[model samples]
Target: MRLLAWWSRRMLSAALTLLLISLLIFAASRLMPGGFAEVVLGPFASAEEKAEVSAKYGLDRGILTQYWLWLSSAVHGDFGLSMITREPVTTEFGLRLPVTAELTILGMAAAIVFGVPLGVLTAIRAGRRGGGALGRLASGFGVSVPEFVLGSLVVFLFSRYALGLTVGGYVPFGTDPAANLRAMVLPAAVLSVFVIAVTARTTRDAVLTVLVEPYIAAAVARGESPGSIVRRHVLRNASIPVITVLGTVTAYLLGGAVIVEYLFNLPGIGSYVVQAVGRRDYAVVQAGVLLAAVVFVVMTTLTDAVAGVLDPRFGRSA
Candidate 1:
């Protein structure tokens, strides 16, 4: 029952957070410099067309009323129609969101693949006398380099290997999974480099601390292999920090997707949002912001659930 209570509280907090986020997105969209009418129709549209479009989306209503109506429509699965396409915003999002989602997944997987073992190794060495020069250098590079710079470096390397060809663009996985992976691999790897550093450094410290506990020493004294001890005892205790880094990394990578998408001209939601914002397309902007916000919330919630499953001490019921 206590665990159930905790779950309920966490879920309620998530809901409230998302609601607040949605409200903020709505307000922010409304405040985008000029009126939506100017942005959507441009100056070429006749006064009559502007009036029709305005009335169509309830822009004739006050900002607050329009927000309420839009929010209600959102709750009912109508994400509003695209002002630019006259098609449903949901359809546009449906097509684009998947690519962004896939890119995010690839980035995260790269992060975990590279981060975990380095973190463990660094932590183990630190427990002895702190990471030596090589470890220090690796960590420094990971922490210091920004994504854009790192991405450029990666592209440079790929360009050499690609032999005058390029590979930073987005290709649909459904159309050709191999090409899609090829295009995304370098960008995803670059995106994850920061996260890898953070996770490794944090895990190293946390595991080193856990190693000093009596149980760890006791296990060592009993002839448990160093590898086994680190894998089971040290890592289990060290996992929370690693998971925290992963959660944060996932969010950052999603945002970073915009940069990658822009560079690659991928039709993912991130790039879509960027283009829409450039054109000041209100519906696309609103949908993209709301969707990204939802993704962030959902990822955090999933992190919590995964942590709960992996580590029961938090007393998570679900």
Candidate 2:
């Protein structure tokens, strides 16, 4: 019941945050510099035409009433029409979400495959081996390099040297799974870098801290093998921070992927959102923002819940 209460409280908090973010996005989209009047008018429209178009879209409605209606529509998954495409926003988003999810999940998987082991190694020999500097340098590289630069370099190498590899496009997995994964590999690798670095650094630090605890010392003195020490003592204690940093990275990964998707033309949410922004597609923008916001809240909730399960002593742990 206590755990359930904690989960409920956190969820409520996330729900409130999500609501505020949605409202902000909706209001801001309407107030964008040229205004809804211009958007409704679209490109090459005259001032009089703009006014007529705005009236047709009901831009004259009061913001509060508009907000309520949009909110209601959002509840029903009616994300309005794309200013640019004239297609339903939900349809566009539905097509894009899975692509982004695939990219994000693969990136996280790469991070885990590399980071957990590196962190464990560094933590096992903190001061004794002094390899933290190497891990730190790796983290610095990951944190400093934006995805675009890495993405371009990746594209260049793959397109130039790789045999039978296509470049600069998206093929849906449902259409051709093999071709889709092939196309996805480069961008996903780029997206994973920052996340992997973060996980490594956090894991190393967390593990080192846990290993130094007196109980860990006692366990070592009792002749616990290094593997056993890590499995039974270090990991158990460090799981909280590991979960935290991983969660933070995961939250940002999809948003960060915009650069890679744009450069690579991946048909993912990142690409969709950027195009929406460029075209001033309000429904697309609104849907993208809401989706991103909801993703953040949900991931935050997942991380907290997972961490509590992994390391129940987290909140009270010193």
Candidate 3:
């Protein structure tokens, strides 16, 4: 009953948050610098044509009314027509979502596989020479370099070396699995770097905190094996914080994906929104951002749920 109640509250909170985000997305899309009518009709369009265009799209409606209409359509999974593409925004999003989803999954998997282990190593060898430097280097690099720059550097290095790898173009996995996987590799790798750095740093801090607990010292005094102690105690206790960080990072990746997709020429939502913004395709922009927000909210909620499961202390608060 307690868990059920907790989940119910969580769902309500998520719904309310999403509602607020949708409103913001609508307002921002509507307020974008250039008038959508002018963009769609071009600069040479007559004033009468622009006015007709605006009225046709209901852009002349008050913002609140426009939001209600957009929200209504969106609730039915109808995101309206793209001003530029003339196709349904939802349809375009559907086509691109899988590409971004696969990329994010691959990147996250790599981040966890590499980051956790590196963090653990750094934590265990905290005072030792060379051990601490690796964590610092990764975190510093991630913080200092913009993802676009990193992506460009990665593309240039791989392309220059001709290491039997493809650089930019994306192939549908259904059409050619091998080629698709090859195309996805560079982008996923690029996306994973910042995640990896973040995960490693977070894990190191969490593990270090766990190591100093009285129970850990007690385990050490009792002649427990180092491996056993770390596996059973250190990791178990450290995981909650790492999980929180991973969840936040996962949400961030959804947004960060745009830059990577553009750099790699992948047809993901990130790149979709970029094109929409360029064309002032309000429908596409609004829907894409709303989708990203939904994903972000979902990830954070799931994170809280998982953390509650792992640490009963969280459940009390829930």
Candidate 4:
């Protein structure tokens, strides 16, 4: 019952947060110079044509009324048509979502696989001669570099050295699995770097804290193997903070994916949003950002739910 109540509250909070985000997106879109009619019909277009376009898109209505109308239609899954392309925003979103989804999944998977182990090793070796200094240095470097710079460098190194890897151009996975993976690899690697650093550092800190606990010493004194003790006692306790950080990493990945996609010319939603913003395609921009926000909120909420499940006390307290 407690868990159920907690989940209910979380969902309600997420909905309210999304509503606020939608309002902000709508307001910003409205504030941009020129309306959809002006952009669509062009400066050479007659005033009559522009007015017709405005009325067609509800652009002629007051800002609040327009926002309310958009919001109402959005709740029913209608994001309206793109001003530039005249295609439904939802259709483009559906088509482009898979590309970004694949990139995000690959980046996240790499981060977890590499980051957790690095954190564990670094934490264990803290204060020793070798002492995880290399790991720490690598994490620092990863976090310090911007994704675009890192991506450009990767492309240069790959091309300069004749590494023979495909650095750009996307292939749909459904059409060619091998080529698709090759195209995605570089971008995904770039996307993973910051997240990997964040996860490793968070894990190291959490594990270090857990190591100092009395139960860890108790486990050690009880004739447990070193590996067994760490596996059973240390990681479980440290996981909550790590999980929480990873949840936030989802947002980072979405934001970073935009740059990464642009650099690599991938047809992902991130790139789509970038293009929409550049062209001032209000419908596309609004829908794309809203979708990203939804994904972020859902991931975070799920992360909290998982944390609560792992530690029942979390449900009670939260």
Tens digit per residue, CA lDDT, model 4, 1-318: 777788889889999999999999999977888766666667789999988877876678898897888889999999999888789999988888888888878888987899999999999999689999999998888889998899999888976786767878789999999999988888889889988998899999999999999999898889999799888999889999999988888765664388888888888888888788767788888998888788789888878888887888877887
Q: What is the lDDT of residue 245 in candidate 4?
A: 87
What ranges in model 4 sit over 4 Å off?
37-52, 254-256
Higher-scoring candidate on lDDT, 2 or 4? 4
Clashes of each: 1, 0, 0, 0
CA shift of 310, model 1, Å: 3.9
Q: Once superposed on the true structure, which residue ranges of model 3 sit more than 4 Å away at CA?
A: none
Clashing residue pairs in candidate 4 (N, C-alpha, C atoms within 3 angstroms): none
Superior by TM-score: candidate 2 or candidate 4: 4
- The estimated TM-scores of all candidates read 0.87, 0.91, 0.95, 0.94
Give the Cα RMSD of candidate 3. Answer: 1.5
- Please name the candidate that would achieve the greatest lDDT relative to the true structure: 3
**Residue 142 of model 2, lDDT score:** 89
lDDT of 3 by residue, 1-318 (tens): 888898899999999999999988888887778888877788899999998988988888888898898899999989999887788887887888789888889988987899999889889988787768867787768757888999999889988897877898789899999999999998998888888888888899999999999999999999999899999999989998899889988887775498899888898988889888888888888888888888889989999989998898897796
Candidate 1 regions exceeding 4 Å error are 40-53, 127-130, 153-165, 254-256, 316-318
Candidate 4's error at 285, in angstroms? 0.8
Lowest lDDT 10-residue stretch of candidate 4: 248-257
Q: How many backbone clashes does candidate 1 have?
A: 1
lDDT of 1 by residue, 170-243 (tens): 67789888888777666666666777778777777777788889999899889999989987888778787678
Q: Of the pair 1 and 4, which is ahead by lDDT?
A: 4
lDDT of 1 at 318: 46
